[model samples]
Target chain A: MITFKNVTKEYPPKTHALAGVSFRIEAGEFVSITGQSGSGKSTVAKMIFAEEMPTSGHIHIGDWDISNIRHSDIPVLRRQIGVVFQDFKLLPKKTAFENVAFALEVAGESTKRIREVVPHVLKIVGLGEKGGRYPRQLSGGEQQRVSIARALVHRPKIIVADEPTGNLDAITAREIIELFTRINDFGTTVVLVTHDRDIVNGLHRRVITLRDGKVSSDAEKGKYLLS
Target chain B: MRSFFRIIRFALQSMMRNFWLSFVTVSVFVLTLVTVNAVIVLNVLANASVKSVEGRVQVTVYFTSDASESTVKNVQSYLLGLSQVKDVSYVTADEALAQFKENHQNDPVILASLDEVDGNPLGQALKIRAYNAGDFPFVLQALETPEYKPFIKDKNYNNYESALRVLSDFSEKVRLGFLILALFFGFIATLIVFNTIRVAIYVHRDEIGIMKLVGANDWFVRGPFLFESICYAFIATVVMGVLLSAFLTFANPAIVAFFQGVDVDLVSYYLTNALPMFGAQFGILALLGLGTTTFAMRRYLRV
Candidate 1:
């Protein structure tokens, strides 16, 4: 579960990235946050990972209030909540399996455990056969799948993806979204942030749209409401 | 312990992946160390040369020919008793006359003048050697006592004293020049290492970000880079050690032959001090590399 209660984040000279935003999603939910370029949806995703702190109010992921989390605790929070970025963010020098295993390695997992779990997760993302391929050798969708596999390696409780399909073609994008759906079906909470209208309309899931740093709409089955 | 091995593995992998960069960094480290060792070699040779020249300089005290043999012997005993005086050899008047004739044998006018003088006119002399050339003045001044002054003919220490001063000054200047050269090389080495790390970090900027985003702690991200810098230091030191041994093997015989009588044995000197000398060089280089790596990481590696 994730909750943001009246959180406000501001930049220098009164540029408000988020203005008094409040939202909550229960466990095992698949949620899409939709917005224009500067609607603060990305900021919301960043806050979930504690990459950005709120200027006022608070953010709580389960029982952890990360509004004033210590610097040393950020990694712990990040490990609990996996983050996927628009760029895929795979280490270019590493193969798909190594990239996935990197997550567990940082967590000090055993080699035997990594060898077992990395292949399993890569298979879940449909990269089992391509585990040895480096990021440069993979297609756009394949790279995104690798990124997802990495996020899933820790079996994180929540997955926050910010524009993960932004660089993919329509077919590949849909495949990635379906992969997220499959992951959610396994009881992992998925929060997808995007501006693509068709992907949102097709999902027909809970949607929270932001406008001018404020939430404009929230519906259990929402469509892309902005032009 | 597992993490430690993983860090080392990652460092080796990174180095191999960036082979040319690693090569350049280590090469620069070796160059810096070569300059440092050159200064050391120059210092050793300079000290040896100075000591050789100092050994040849001694004060000769000439006593009048009529001065008794007992009196000259007493003077030698007195000079030898001082801690600063290393040795004093008494030359009889007859031996002095013979040495004078031998030295002037090629000069007909000097030999004729020496033959015309009353039989064996040269005086008994005492050659006084001191532990340090600077102590000659004190030794010479000691002879001015009234008991010995009446029989004394001449003392020749002032000439050698001026020559020693000039030699000392030149040696000091040479040492100072090499020091400046070494420092300049060290500065260039620091800059190159700093830039090398910065460039390597830039090349891996995306990887570093990915690692951090994937939940790597600060040490986990920094470990490989710090280890890589240490590897460069270790490799460069080993390479330098091999190169110096080869150089000494080829150059020692020629050096000994050139300074024939000067007792300059570079091979032996290096052999005796190799462990401490190389150990100190490695320590300094490792410290420098670590410092530069930390600074570069702080500037460019946000994680």
Candidate 2:
């Protein structure tokens, strides 16, 4: 579960990225946060992972207030919440298998366990046979799948993806969305932040749309409402 | 312990992946060490030359022909008792006469003069050497007592003092010059190493961010770069050791022949001090590398 109450972020010289936005999502829910450019959608996703702290107000994830997280605690919080970025963020020198295994290695997992779990997670993201391929050798869709496999390696409770499909074609983007749906079915909360109207309208899932740093609409089965 | 091995493995992998960068870094380290060792060799040779010159400077005292042998022996004993005196050799009147004839054998006029002289006209002499060249004046001054002055014909200390002073000054200047050169090279080496680490961190900037995103701690991110610096130091030291051995082997004989009996055995000096010398070089270079690595990481590596 994630909750934000009266969160506001401001930059220098009168720029507000977020203004008094409040939202709550229960466990095991798939929610799409939709908005056009400059809608603070990515800012919301960064806040969930504690990459950026709220300039004002509080944020809570499962009863733990991360409004002012300590520097040392950020890694622990990040390990609990897997983040997927549009660029995929895979190490260029590492193969798909090594990239997935890196997440477990940082957690100090045993070699035997890594050999076991990395292959299993790569298979889940449809990258089982392409584990030895480097990121440069993989297609854009394949690279995004590798990123998802890395996020799932720790079996995190929540997956926060900020525009993960932004770099892929329409078919690949839809496939990525379906993968997120499959991951959500396994009881992982998915927060997909995007501005793509076709993807959001096709999902017919719970949608929270932001306008001018405020939530403009929240619907149980929302469609894309932006022009 | 497992994580430590893993860090080392990762460092080796990174170094090998960027082979040209690693090569350049180690080459710079070796160049710096070569300059340092050149300074050391110069210092050793200068010290040997100064010592050889000091060994040749002694004071000879000539007594009058009328001085008794017993009085000359007493003077020798007194001079020997001084702590500054390393050795004192006495030449009796007859031995001095014989040595004088042997020296003038090649000159007809000197030989004829020596033959016409009265029986054993040459006086007894004492050749005195001091542990330090500067202490010779004090040793010669000790012989100016009333009992010894009447028989003392001449002292040669004044002839060597000025020359010794010039030699000492020249050696000191040489040492100071080499020291300054060494320091300049050390500064340049530091800058090169600092920039090398910065470039390495810049190249890995994206990888570092990805590591942090995947939940790596700060040490996990920093360990590989620190280990890589130590690797550069170690490889450079080993290469310098090989190069020094080759240089000494090729240059020692020529250096000895050039100095011509000046007791300049560079090979022996380096052989005796190889362990401590090389160990200290490696230790200092590794410390420098580690310090610069830490500084670069703090400035460039956000994690």
Candidate 3:
């Protein structure tokens, strides 16, 4: 579970990235955070991973009060919350297997565990057969799948995918979304940060839409609408 | 333990993946060591040259005809007592005349002139050798003491002054120039390494960000670059050692022939101290490479 209570993240010179953004994500739920560019959806995902801290108010992932997490503890927090970036963020030199294995390796997982978990995660993301391929060798969708495979390698409780389908085609985007839905069905929390209208309408899941650095609507089954 | 192995594996993979960068870094390191070793060789040669010149210089203090043999012995004892004078050999008037005749035996006129002169006209001499060429002046100045000044007809200190000055000054200047050259190359090598590592880090900046996002610790992120630096240092050191060995082997004969009577055993010198000397070079290169790599990675590690 993650909670943002009246959280505000302000850049200097009076620029507010997120103004008193309040939201609660329960465990085992799939949540979509939809907003325009600069609407602070990605910022929310970054805060959840402790990559950014709010200027005011509270942000908690489970019982860990990450609003003021220590520098040494940031890595520990990151290991628990799997984050997928918009650009895939795969290391070019590492093969698809190594890219996924790196996540577990960073967490100091045993060699046997990494050996076991990476293949399982790649299989989950439907890239089990192409583990030997490098990032450049794979297509855009396949690269995005590798990124998701990396996020799942640690068996994290919450998977935060920030515009993961941004670089993929319509069918590929839906495929990635379907993968996330399947992941969510396994009782892991999924926070999808995207502005894709069709994807958001198709989700039929809980959605928190942001506008003007504030939450404009919260619905159980939200529809995508630009305001 | 597994993490340690993983770090080493990553370092090897990174180095191989960026083969050209590694090669360039190691080449710069080898060139830096080359400059340093060149400076060391120049210093050893200069020291040997100075010593050879100093050995050739000896001031012979000739005594007047009236001075007795005992008086010459007293002067010789006095010169020997002085710390600056390394050795003092007393040459009698008769012995000096015999040496003169032996030297000019090919020139009959000079030999006949020396034989015709009445009963050993050459003065008794005290040939003084000083420990250092620079100290020769002080040894000559010590002769101004009232004890042996009156009996001493002529001191040959001024005869060797210009030669000693030239030898000492030239050796000093050569040593200084070599030092400056060594430092210049060292500075250049440092910059080349710093820039090379910076470029490598820039190339992997995105991967570094991803690594951090995946929960890699600071060491986990930096281990590959740091270990790669040590690898470059190790390779460069070995290459430099082999090159130096080959150079000394092929060049020693020419150098020995050029130096004629001068004692310059470069092969022996390097062979005796190769371990500690090359160990220091490797240590310094590794330290410099690590420092530059750490500095280059600082901005990228912010994530």
Candidate 4:
């Protein structure tokens, strides 16, 4: 349920981050957006999160025009979409459980709801045993799983992982991809943004490749071709 | 009610988590409140003492000793008839001479000089008390009238007028000084509160940002800070009240003995008689604390 209709994003001084890009991600779809550095993959994810508004096009997320979302309403939009960053931006002071619970708390979830939903999401990401551990205490994969658990707390309609495994080892990156696959199987729309060709090739899902700020190829069950 | 307790519990936990910062904030607020309360208390005491002094002072008019007793009696009757006069007492020249001797008993030279004066030169004097300290001018106006000029003693007027002028000037100075002190302390108190809140804001910056992200309304975020400020001021006010009461309790007897001949007792008079007035002062201070804290936190909490 994500649509970017002819979105053209231009930075100042003739720098076009995304030029005339059009794409639609249906609900329950698992998709990978692949582009090399400066190819605007991250910009696409940021637009979906309303972190950056498109310069000249409409963005619709499930019937909501998020293009003009006010700063105050950003948090509300964020609750509807689960976001995972490569750096795993978890508060270091909190345990894995607290980090996930914080998302629910910020959403004003009841204590009962938080207690019930937090452990369930943590278990879904295979972090059930690491709930009590702090971010530093967990492995990189485990930490990313905690971030995934946080994203799932509100049963968000879309899960956008922007280069989530960029800093992890290949094995850990594959493990994170597997977790995302499992989450996508449960009916949540998953959009994975990455530049790693090996990982993109392994995921035989829809691939949208960007080249010089334009969509170069949109193919079902695609391969990474960046020449 | 449960939500309120939750908010308070969260605040206390955060405050305890940052104990050193909270203590600093509380101490600052207390210091400011103490100065403000001290000024208020001093103002109250000064006003009370002025009223007491005003109640004791009267205008005394001396008659010419060579004048007939009938003329002196007429003057006394005339003073009694005036609406401004509360009471009048006539002291004959013989009695006045005896009182003068008794007053100068410690000074033999003064006593001998007074005794050597021919035939008790002191005249019959009428001491007149007025309804209010301000009404003294009205009585003076009556005495200076042309009708009463024949019986007036110019020297008596000259002596008593200077005393009256000095008393009036002292009361006005005391009043002006009290007001200035109160205003100065009030401004300092407000600044102290403002700085204290700013420091607390710096310490809890993260919590505040997180609280805002969690959909907390502006009031919910402000409530705890407001509560903290009031707590500091209220505790200081109570402590100052107790210490002041104890001080007045133990020192009252000495004060009463010192001013025994005066019309009012300073300490006991306030403790027993002006308790309600003191309570009002406390209430005003509590409100001042609230107001100052609220004002200080305004810019810091605008988010």
- By TM-score rank, best first, the candidates go 2, 1, 3, 4
Candidates' RMSD to native: 2.7, 2.7, 3.7, 5.1
lDDT of 2 at A146: 98
Give the range where candidate 1 chain A is weakest over 10 consecutive residues by summed lDDT. Answer: A68-77
Measured against the true two-chain complex, the DockQ scores of the candidates, in the order shown, are 0.69, 0.67, 0.70, 0.21
How far residue B4's Cα lies from its native spot in candidate 4, in Å, is 7.4
Please tell me which model should have the higher DockQ, number 1 or number 2: 1
Judged by DockQ cut-offs, is candidate 3 incorrect, acceptable, medium or high? medium
lDDT at B207, model 4: 57
Q: What is the iRMSD of the candidate numbered 4?
A: 4.2
Give one digit per residue, the lDDT tens place, for model 2 in A5-98: 9999998889899999999999999999989889899999999988778999899988668897787878788888888999999998899999
Give model 2's docking category: medium
Better of 1 and 3 by lDDT: 1
Once fitted onto the true fold, the runs of candidate 3 whose alpha carbons sit more than 4 angstroms away are A225-227, B61-98, B101-161, B299-301
Per-residue error at B17 for model 3, in Å?
A: 3.6
In model 3 chain B, the worst 10-residue window by lDDT is B294-303
Q: Per-residue lDDT for A139 in model 3?
A: 94
lDDT of each: 0.89, 0.88, 0.87, 0.76
Q: Model 3 lDDT vs. the true structure?
A: 0.87
Shift in Å, residue B95, candidate 4: 4.3
TM-score of 2: 0.91
> Which regions of candidate 2 are displaced past 4 Å?
B93-121, B258-264
